[model samples]
Target: MFSLYVFHLTPIQTKNPYPTKELDFYSILWSVLFVKLLIYFLAFITY
Candidate 1:
């Protein structure tokens, strides 16, 4: 599921022509944290 979500973002990220490396790095970091929280939420719901 996590891989699928990241895979989905790949095209969108590439499509953005702006080459702000730092901003992209930060956004990716935030996305990883968001994914972790989402996974935790889903696990809690399942439990």
Candidate 2:
């Protein structure tokens, strides 16, 4: 079961063949959202 999961994830883990500007914008947006979530979680922990 674990090997099967790894096999499925392998292709998704590969780098993009041709990343465009749109991809970069989306990635930046995703990173911002991730940071926001992390901060929220940390605040919740401290409060």
Predicted model with the maximum lDDT:
1
lDDT of 1 at 20: 79
CA shift of 11, model 2, Å: 8.6
What lDDT tens digits, residue by residue, belong to model 1 across residues 1-47?
A: 66766775676577775567955875687688878989898999999
Error of 1 at 5 (Å): 15
Name the weakest run of 10 consecutive residues (lDDT summed) in model 2: 4-13
To one decimal, what is the Cα RMSD in angstroms of model 1 from the true structure? 3.6
Runs of candidate 1 exceeding 4 Å displacement: 1-19
